[model samples]
Target: MSEPKRMGRMGRRPGHGPGGGMMPGEKAKNFKGTVRKLIQYMGKYKIAILAVLTFAVASTAFGIAGPKILGQATTELFNGLVAKVSGTGEIDFGKIGRILLFLICVYAFSALCSFVQGWIMTGVTQKVCFRFREDISSKINRMPMKYFESRTVGEVLSRITNDVDTLGQGLNQSVTQLITSVATLIGILIMMLSISPVMTLIALVILPLSGILIGIVVKFSQKYFVAQQKYLGEINGQVEETFSGHNIVKAFNKEEDMLKEFHGTNDMLFQSAWKSQFLSGMMQPIMGFVGNLGYVAVAVAGGMLVVRGSIEVGEIQSFIQYVRQFTQPITQVAQVSNMLQSTAAAAERVFEFLGEEEEDLTAEHPVKLENMEGRVSFEHVQFGYRPDQVIIHDFNCQVKPGQTVAIVGPTGAGKTTMVKLLMRFYDVNQGSIQVDGHDLRDFNRSELRENFGMVLQDTWLFKGTIMENIRYGRLDATDEEVVAAAKAAHAHRFISTLPGGYEMELNEDASNVSQGQKQLLTIARAILADNPILILDEATSSVDTRTEERIQRAMNNLMKGRTSFVIAHRLSTIKDADVILVMKDGDIIEQGSHQELLAQHGFYAELYNSQFEAA
Candidate 1:
């Protein structure tokens, strides 16, 4: 239960590799499939999405009409000036004023439409994010223990946090922008063509050139972007590992080696990042150059048309404005393409997690054995964490009600594995584990677990008061009961001496307290649970001899009428057990009272002798 070992089993981010980092805009392997899945997931929000799309189109259409409408004002002003110059008519100031006011109203209405769509889209995105998080949380509880053991904690958490968040933000932006970009492109094209199809054709020449340039930049930069993301994760992992194990590195005098490793990772990250940024950066300027060429060509073509009376002078101004507006949507489309990839990647991860194999907690004809007396039996149980590697073989054991069974073995002797099997954390590959003559699987997993209490070597305490932490064992337990359990576990005395007594709040990880204190809190939790069956795995390992003695006395009282399985490394703790089972490799080598096992002079005797010899 060392810190690093605990972290390896359940670390928060586990470095910035697959499980950590936002990793925005990453390419998805199955882009089309993922997008299809996302659309299916979002099907319930179709109405809201449709509203957003409608409003987005309306906003773009209204925005597109601004330049053309203003062009009308320009035409009116030009006509008035020509008339005044020719001394035929006075300038129509009132008409020009009316036209300007109408243009303002149109722009204002467009802004309003944009705001309404954004608000609606944001709500939809957040709702989708909320559902994703809820589903992931629920999915975790239904998942098999093996699934968690086979992956890092961060990897699972990434689906709920990073992936969902990325999906939400990308969804909010990409959907609206895509709709607006396409709408704007279409609306602008029609307006340009309406004014002068010849000049519109001239303006359209920028598309292929811009497309080729953008395609080349994206093609070259994509690999670098991927590499940059990879090396960034690697470098972050190095930094996290180094800092978390700084003391170990210093103790081993490996500072130089750590630094060298960091330098190597950092250099690679730098190379990829700069190259990707430089190549992607070239996109805007290149597009702008091509656009400027198109603008110049359109300007020349419009002027020729204007001189020949093919189009009006004000029409030339409107066409130039349309040309400028045209390139923006194309740029947005390119940008949205990258965003969609990111959205697809994030959505894919989330969908993958939600689609994982879940444990079948539902038993069709569940055995309802109430008032369980805790008679347990492991009949020819065989199991392994992996299918190909069987660890426990023919692990047969039986314990009557209200008996203390002590399992003693070396580190890799399948001691903990048996406890896990009994609890149904994992099912036996061969044979069955039964409780009160009923197969473990016959009962619902939750109902089966409700009859047992567990206190492990590795203590876990959330950020809460000592009373709350203890009361976690039984949510409805009163304050007096919590305090009583704490006293039984010998944690009350230390708790009372603290600043807030039983009301003292523990920090995250509970590092504010000593290891022994944390262990005592967990023991208190188990005691408060008051279950019919108890499993204690090296529960007293963290405490000193004096505190251990006190807790042992309390444990003796607590186990008075309950069936208890005590898995211990320290042989002295289980001397008074009703039966001592000594396991070696996988099977039990000997089973008897402590005195009887000592008389056998076998593996258990050797193990007991070695501990005293070392002491």
Candidate 2:
């Protein structure tokens, strides 16, 4: 059977729409640090970035020059009309036509520059996102099992998908907008000042007021934006859990409870989302209002100067257009703070994951297993998932080469923990587990793991053909070898009966096959591996008695001349084991042959007899 998927904690939730922001309960504490690191990532594409900047500057310059040049046409038209009214000269239609053509060429050139900048920036954003995802994928392998144990698949997936997407969007849109806004603001200020310093002073009065207003709104909105992203991650995690475990939920009749929990998170997300959107949405209108006020003041003041013969009407027109252009960038600047807040929040989550403690892979003079005899020993081993509380304490065991040892116990006896420790999934807190006189820690982890084969109770099968799944045990195994292993494990009969035979494809979750069939495939995989050591955890518990008998016969053949550890809930299966170790509460309570333990009438005997009595 497929493994039961684990669930994670549900915190604040985000909106239902894709890419909607929801606030997290905790904000990213190191916002500046994340931003600095993001900047450093962008530094890798310096030449492309420089080209984008150059194009943006050119685009803005051409755009900014349009209104001022159009003002000159207005001035010429006004002068020509006055001359015609005075009967002193004819209106200069040729000059006006030339000015109109120049304006069209300038605007077209500006559009081309903007398009090139956007195209280049898109490439930059995609390349950077690619690098970020690559690093994250590599980092996942280096991380310890404890990291995955503490987090959920959904939470980790959210970081890789949603957070990386947020960062990419911020780079693509926010970065370029920031550059354009600042450049436009500065260039317009210079144009306005050059036209008339008095009108420029009037426009300057509104700048501080606008800044203060934006500051207040952005200050309140930043927290919500941060919360929005956090909630988004939580919502994603909850969705993943609920969907993966939908069958369990239905079996347990938890529909109402699940709905209630989802609604609670959804409501929290709504509250955060609306507030963030509302505040950010206010910037444009507020800036527009302030901008219009500045426009009126500049127009009225410029009109008085025009009447006093200090400035021309065309210059006033240009100054008013400059004032409008100036306020747009201010509005964009205000909106960018919200975008930056979201980016920083997403970056912090990703960076926090990337910065998690990786397993210590360092070994001084690492040993390699050559001609492995599979003589295993545990001497004074101690361990716990957490450091403050130890579970397995001072455990000791020894197994000779080619011996079949069975470990029997009730649930939570740390049976699986022992297997994990032997495979170096978790390092022991005290003493050592050794293979052939060398400490397991001293051996190179990959080489050490290669010596053991595992057939877990929860069989894992990826989306592939049956033949391909069997070949996973030995990547370079031939098609004939895979079929031979399947025959040895008694999986070939069932696989041949399927419509496509060995070439039958499994679904993503391998749900197309029955539970017993999946188990048989896993057995076939293990048989193909041909490792010196094997760990079988309830390998046949999911199959029928007849199938179990077949599997036991196959396992006996596979276990010949190999050290094997069998973990079983069914006491009858391990009756012929060389040694049967009975455990409880993380420590072994008894060890002997099956007949010897039965004679003692202790834990093993009681456990063994209970199965029979229940049957």
The RMSD (Cα, Å) of candidate 2 is 3.8
| Estimated TM-score for each candidate | 0.95, 0.88
List model 1 lDDT by residue over 198-222, tens digit each: 8877777668988988889989998
Q: Tens digit of lDDT per residue, candidate 2, span 484-568?
A: 9999999999999998999999987777999899999999999999999999999998899999999999999999999999999
Question: What's the lDDT for candidate 2?
Answer: 0.85
Total colliding residue pairs, candidate 2: 6
In the predicted model 2, the residue pairs found to clash are 22-227, 22-228, 22-229, 23-227, 23-228, 24-227
What is candidate 1's TM-score against the reference?
0.95
lDDT of each: 0.88, 0.85
- Worst lDDT 10-window in candidate 2: 1-10
